[model samples]
Target: MSVHETIEQALVAPSYLAGGGDPGWVTVPLHRACDWSYGHDPLMPRVILTSPDQQATLRIDPDPDEPWWTVRHARCGDRPAWSATFDARTPVEIIAALTDALTAPTPPAPGLEPYDLLRQAGWHTVGEGLISPGRIAAIEHYGGEDGPWFADARLDQDEGGLIWRAYLSNTTPPHLIAAFAQALADPTPVRRPVGRVPAPAREHTLTRTVHLPVGDVAFALEQRVAALSARRKDATSNTHPPRSPRVPPPRRTR
Candidate 1:
């Protein structure tokens, strides 16, 4: 088979495990699979499947020139939480591996030690273990808006763990920090299944015969550009809060 034909066949295959509607498995759009940045790559033929909670995204990008496909596990953002490449496997085996990887419990957020989770969650890190001006601003802003709820808010290290810190203060309510920590840790809640579930559908399929040298490669290239342009537009237009995975709650020493 031609390279394009091989890639298309693989892309169209059912690569995700089947499960119930919610708290189960579902297919996500190609653009939503990984960051649009990855889809923009000319040589990577990509597809993605996501769990209902939006906590996990499984990305499959087949190398056009090679026999293997690169699989990535991602959270809500563009960066993959984990990744691996598979070769000498059928589409079924690839899907099984993808399922195993996704269903497995996620490890701690990548680089939490060097890259502070607080900094990643929109709090700025200042010198000598101080909070950033931006982080203080955010705290103050939220504190003002939230009233007495945030009055005593301050960042404190989780008792023995270095992975997380608690927002604590004498007057600040415990739940306040608890909720914030939860939100920071599991930013993407498990998405409940939506209504009237349509059977899972393939977002893209090769309809007619596509010759490799001309039509298929050209089409793939066009898709890459389109995906890239869309991502650029999103980057320019949207102002989104930084996200972090659910970290262990700060030790409640209060």
Candidate 2:
């Protein structure tokens, strides 16, 4: 079968359980996990699969110049945490790796200071335990309609060194939320070296302009005219009442 057919079948196939009765083994939609594009070139196909926790991602995309497919596994947005290359013929091996990644345990969340944790949670920290204008705006936006219930957090410095206060959103998973809560309560300061701010995410816009032959263009225009005429006729009919039957027919019958 063709590569496309193979991938489609794999997607639709039953979830591959790593071990017997493992509940974590769940089927993930290809679009949600990967950055696969419908318009990607067939010669250099790409596929990515992310773990359920959003910690790990597996990518399979061959470089245009390279003959082998570059299969990479990353954790916490770290690209190529682990990687390997395979010949074009070995798609099965690549699929196996992706399946393995699905069941793999996510690496522990990085140790973060109280101030840094707030920043990671979509808050902007201006000074020590202080909020930024952007963070205030975010809080307001989150409390508005179509926003999560747990919108903002309150931080203060009391007799205790630092006080972090936040309510858990109903939407937040219990286990993950508890982890965050525990991390915030911990007294130990962050030991890891602070990493530089990551660059903003790249945005892509696709524009396609189709050039049609004269014959096709003319046909399209004719169709549009017909559609408009039908619409106008319907509108005119709706605006006016139906005409009554003539009384001459009744007189002739009499």
In TM-score terms, candidate 2 sits at 0.21
TM-score of each: 0.20, 0.21
> For residues 203-242, could you state the per-residue lDDT of candidate 2 as single tens digits?
1111122333445433433553354445546656877879
Q: Candidate 1's residue-wise lDDT over 155-194, tens digit each?
A: 2333221211122233332332333332332222121122
Q: Residue 241's C-alpha lDDT in candidate 1?
A: 48
- Candidate 1 clashing pairs, residues 3+ apart or interchain: 53-190, 53-191, 185-245, 185-246, 185-247, 186-246
lDDT score of model 1? 0.33
Candidate 2 minimal-lDDT segment of 10 residues:
9-18
Question: Any runs in candidate 1 off by more than 4 Å, and if so which?
Answer: 1-45, 66-68, 74-80, 88-91, 94-98, 104-254
lDDT of 2: 0.32
Q: State the C-alpha lDDT per candidate.
A: 0.33, 0.32
